[model samples]
Target: MEVRSAPSLLPILRSRQQGEVLTYLMCDPDRETSMSELAHRVGVPLSSVHREVERAEAAGIITSRRSGNTRFVRADTDSPYYDSLSDLLVKAFGPPHVLAEALEGVEGIEAAYVYGSWAARLHGVAGRRPVNDIDVLVLGEPDRAELYEALGGVEGRLGRPVNVVIRDAGWLRDGSGSFHATVTERPVVAIEIKKQLGRDPVPQSS
Candidate 1:
């Protein structure tokens, strides 16, 4: 696929899919993933992801191997571009992924989403001003202190401020406020929080 001419959050990349694919592989170099899982995580179609992975592999940006009938890919750590490119990806396209990782096992959280300008840009909405910070909306009854503490370092990691808004699940379902209305009306990207297994679980009581 040809590079998009439209302005993108990561201006240097060919397409959002390209950025997502590269970020997923490069930012987590130690992990290897199947193409289908890569597609699911990046929210891009399998065909598009396959093409991007093929191009990246051809350029030595990533490497792939066959595991039975499955094709798995990972970042080529030896590539001269690995270090710099991974850093760039982490800064530009790493919010949802990074936030998800950070909030993975935090208790009392039902769902999380990134909304506002960052989401607008991710959803391909052209904007007049550059996105300066991330706005996250959490839906659940998580401990306020714990939630904030969990997200404390996100700003440093992303090199920008992260403003999070907490709302209970009841409010999301029944509230009629303008804030709720606006958020429901706008583009929001869901953060996928995977459960941590085979490790000591976070204590329910401190």
Candidate 2:
């Protein structure tokens, strides 16, 4: 059985709990979760969940409200809790900041954003690591040769080759005009606005 800590300890303990809440919310930001459910998932009692939820709400870590008889919870990443949770995530997942320099400093590269499972693990950043091949969503409609040039730039920068994706709305349909549901289905982690913009360029945060 877990003993309830002193009132003063609540503040200290809430940080970790806040991180848990954020992790859940990050998976699906729109849905609402209940206090009882959250307590069960976290292995804490309802009363503690209530108190922590209240504190987190005040700190803007999460937003809570009464829906009839239930209190719902979700992570507010824009809140300061984001920084703490991000740090915890890095500690939990093996650190891989080295990938940033590899992807970022390449010439002719329009823009890059991470997507997929590895991207989910990174803090609101959309890229995965320990991946067999890096999956990056790039922008523009460069020809195959031009695209190869851009990809080569990334390969040179990273000391390893990475697949480069150039997004083009104009190329939405090929000769057959068939839909490429594949690109639309790509999992999105975060939408990045490029410091260097061209077309509808968005970065996948890492």
Candidate 3:
């Protein structure tokens, strides 16, 4: 499963300060959810949760209806965009990238960015189909692409396919990036600190 693109998740991410709230609601397992339960689960103030819910409803990511005093939220998975994004997620989390990073034994890889589906889950939006393969952006080096290729080979020896995205420290310094804006958002995972450490609590070292 290879994902070139997903539903314009860009819209969902940029939908305001409540991006995490709406994302959690859509990814919740319940077909229809209640306002109070949602607020409680997200651990935000009731008022702030309500504000986000309203914004999400307007964006059409969720469907809400009143039954007596409760409002239910069901994800619009039927939306034309849902399938595309879901498929991308299936392909994205295929294998853990920590396997590669730990084996490489090369320091200065700097920041390892786990973008895409796994990041969405970290923010509390778990897709039905999650692959868990680490999708990373390696922010380091003077030459971006060439450096990525070199690191990719190092991981290749470790048996994990590493898609290392090298970012030129100088270019990053200059702020000329109009291309990588899509992946710059926060990572989608539950244990975010594991991302920085470059190792899982339980190593899958079969």
Candidate 4:
């Protein structure tokens, strides 16, 4: 017997690549992204990203231009579907970037990742049920109270609960827990936290 999987996070899109492409471009409409950068960020081949860009361009979802030997693209903000599509992508595929932005300036966070079912979908894994929440793994000694406060409204923005698991860097390097083993073996989306200058590195009490 065979089992069937549920639809992806955005069933309206034809493929995960399509969703990823749109998400990266639409979520950051103000910036122009190079094709190579898009491919690198989307974790797909250049040729594959090019095809998706062409399809999106043909549909007026994005616009592209060439500079020297590189091609840059951004969301077509003039399109009628731009607003709604961007909102959808933000809710469906924008966790890593969104969470990264939200976590910025909070002291003592060395690294972060989005794992579990939402990440499984981002990794193109088909599941029996749709993802209903986001799981985040934070490796650092960030103040728990500050951390939670930073992420307080993420659920309201993403339309799903955001579950965060915090641990020290040592745990990631040498932990023997079953949970650590599972997360290490699975696909996890890395979240980049930009450290702000002039901010104290002290970890506040919870």
Q: Highest TM-score among the candidates is held by which one?
A: 1
Error of 4 at 184 (Å): 2.7
The better candidate by lDDT, 3 or 4, is: 4
Which candidate, 1 or 2, has the higher TM-score?
1
List where candidate 4 sits over 4 angstroms from the true fold. Answer: 1-7, 196-206
What lDDT would each prediction earn against the true structure? 0.80, 0.47, 0.47, 0.79
Question: What is the Cα root-mean-square deviation between model 4 and the actual structure?
Answer: 6.8
User: lDDT, candidate 3, residue 168?
Assistant: 43
**RMSD of each predicted structure:** 6.6, 13.4, 13.7, 6.8
Question: Could you tell me the lDDT of residue 139 within candidate 3?
Answer: 53
Clashes per prediction? 0, 7, 12, 0
Decide which is better by lDDT, 1 or 2: 1
Tell me the lDDT of candidate 1. Answer: 0.80
Per-residue lDDT of candidate 4, residues 1-206 (tens digit): 11123327777777667777888898777979999998888776788888889999999989999999989999999999999888898898899878988899678888888888888776667788878999998877899999998887677778788899998766666777799777776777777676733221222110
lDDT of 1 by residue, 101-188 (tens): 8887678777788888888787677788888999998877788888888788677878788999987755556667788777767777
